[model samples]
Target: MSTLKSRLDVVEQKISEAASNSGRSRDDITLVVVSKNNPAQMVLDLAEIGVSNFGENRDQEAKPKAAEVALAGKTVTWHFVGQLQSNKAKSALSYSSVLHSLDRPSLLDAVGKAVADRAEPLDVFIQLNLTDDQNRGGIQTQNVLGFAEQVLQTPNLRLLGLMGVAGLDVDPRVDFDRIRNSSEQLMRLAPDAKYISAGMSEDFEFAIASGATHVRIGTAITGKRPY
Candidate 1:
């Protein structure tokens, strides 16, 4: 087996074990291979081996990469998993089927305008800032519900759930638990918005155990960034 496939197999095994230990099935989780800083050929290779979901954080990088993948005739779900700028909203929405960082009112307004008249609602997750820093990429913990309400009211935007990153030097599960609680709160407002988009390479297992429906993993499966 190729080294990439070998690494992928190991991560899949760990995911299965984590899900089973948490009383959930492997199918219950969606493994979004975070391909930021990696090449499009890597995404095509993983897709050839059955990886159907890929994530990118930057529109500039993702647009050309996504076009290359499509030109090669490979079909895959694209997820935008980084803090998005307002000006890039339309471009990001062009290829990304799911947006994991719908954090601010201006972004919501931007997305709402971009997707106006589209046939499908743009799938989105309200990112929750797990740290005390006000300038972080995600929504403040206290403002999540209020922001979620705004998301629901917007046109052509589907409120998926909450996404968060654990603070530095803290046990990951602590933040995962907080994400779960925030998801629960979001669900009360939009019951179908029960999905939690948490976890990365370091703490995905903890996130899965704490009810993460989507795990954005990089390096473990994609290896180190070239840059």
Candidate 2:
């Protein structure tokens, strides 16, 4: 087995243990292997290991990376998880099957315009900034419902759930609760949107206990991205 395969095995084992501790079935959680900044071969290595979902945080890098992965004849679900811009909407949407960074009215409008009349609507999550930094890519807590309503109004985009990352100084538990609470509020608005996406190598266990349906893991599973 490859060295990366060994790391992935360990990460999956840790996930199983976390699920057991949280009383949630391991199957209930989706592991989104984060491949941002990692080479395409590294990503294919993950695909070979049976990962169906991968997350990328940039448009320029992700677009070609995905194309290369496809050219190599491997298919995987790519998720756009970075701060999104209105200009890159089309290219970003092209590579991403699900997007975890839907945050503003303009972006909602841009995506609706970009994907309108496509065969499939894109799955999207409203990013809830667990920190005080507004520029950090999530809509503020007070604006989640309003933003979600915008998402619902936006054509060709399905509001899947909420996504968040803990702030540098914040506690993981608190950050995750805020994200889970956002999901609860969102469900009241749109019951079908029930996926809570959060956590990472450092705190996925806490996120699982707090009701995250999906966790984006990078270094722990793939090791550090080679610069």
Candidate 3:
């Protein structure tokens, strides 16, 4: 098997094992292969093998890469998974069907305007700031509910629960549990918004155990980023 195919198989097996351990089915989780710095060809290759969801972090990269994949006639769901600049909302919205980093009011407003006339509502996750870092990209735990309320009110945006990154040195399940708690709280407001977007290359197993419905994994399956 090709290295990419081998790596993908291993990740899928691990995901299946994680889901089984969590008392959930493998189908319950959506694996978003983060194609941030990876090339479009890699995405196309994966798509050909039934990987329908791919994630990109930068508008500059995603724009051209998405275009390339589209031009090649491959159909894939694009997820924008990085901190977004308000001014780039239009650009990002143009290609992504899902935005995994909807964190602030300014971004919400920008996205609202950008998708006002689109035929489909953009699926979004309210990013959570797990730490006390003021410079971090997500909304703090205390403010996530209010922000989620705002996202629910916005036109052309579908709230998809919470997205977070566990602190590098801490146990990942701690952060994953926090995300699940927040997701439960969000569901009290909008039940359909119960999907938790957490975990990555190193900690997806822990995330799955904590009820993460969507895991954004990259390097483990995509290989070392060329950049």
Candidate 4:
């Protein structure tokens, strides 16, 4: 097997184990391989191994990479998962099928406008700030529900779910609980929005138990990314 195929098998094994331990089915969680700086060829290699979902952090990088993959006749689900500036919203909307980091109202407005103009119904996740760190890009926990409502009202933007990263200081389980609670709040407003995209390579098990339907994993599967 090729290196990408071997690595994919390991990742699949880990996800199965994590799901089994959590009393959830292996199919319940979708793994979104983060291909931030990785090349489009590597993404294509992973796709051959049955990885259809991938995520990227920057607009400039994601835009060209996504186009290249599409041009090569590969169908991959692209997720935008970074701090988005309003000016970059149009470019992000062009490439990403789902925007996973909608944290602020102004950013939401920008995305809404872009989606409306494009006439594409884009899936969006409300990023929640589960930690005390102000530098993290997400809406404060107290404002999640309100933000979900705002997201729901946006034209051509579908509020698909919530996303969060665990804080460094707290236990992974505790952080996951916070994310679960916030997800519950979002569900109250948008019943159709059912995804909770939390967890990484380190804490995906906890995140699965806490009800994460999607997990973004990188290094564990692709090996260390090129800096």
The 0-to-1 C-alpha lDDT of every candidate, in the order given, reads 0.92, 0.88, 0.91, 0.86
The 10 consecutive residues of candidate 1 with the worst lDDT sum are 218-227
Question: What is the lDDT ranking, best to worst?
Answer: 1, 3, 2, 4
Indicate the worst ten consecutive residues by lDDT in candidate 2. Answer: 218-227
- Could you give candidate 1's per-residue lDDT for residues 1-227 as a string of tens digits? 29999989999999999999999999999999999998889999999999999999999999999999999999999999999999999999999999999999999999999899778999999999889888888898889988888899898888989999988889998999999988888788899999999889988999999999999999999889551
Q: In model 3, where do residues sit more than 4 Å from their true spots?
A: 225-227
Q: What's the true lDDT of residue 48 in model 1? A: 94
Best by lDDT: 1
Candidate 3 has an lDDT of 0.91
Superposed model 1: Cα runs more than 4 Å off: none
Whole-model lDDT for model 1 versus the true structure? Answer: 0.92
TM-score of each predicted structure versus truth? 0.98, 0.96, 0.98, 0.94
Cα misplacement distance, residue 37 of candidate 3 (Å): 1.5
Cα lDDT tens digits for candidate 3, 71-103? 999989999999999999999999899999999
Stretches of candidate 4 exceeding 4 Å from the true structure: none
Per-residue alpha-carbon lDDT of model 4 for 135-227, expressed as tens digits? 878988998888888888888888888899998788988988888887787778878888899999888878888999999988877778562
Evaluate residue 114 in candidate 4 and report its C-alpha lDDT on the 0 to 100 scale: 86
Using TM-score, rank the candidates from best to worst: 1, 3, 2, 4
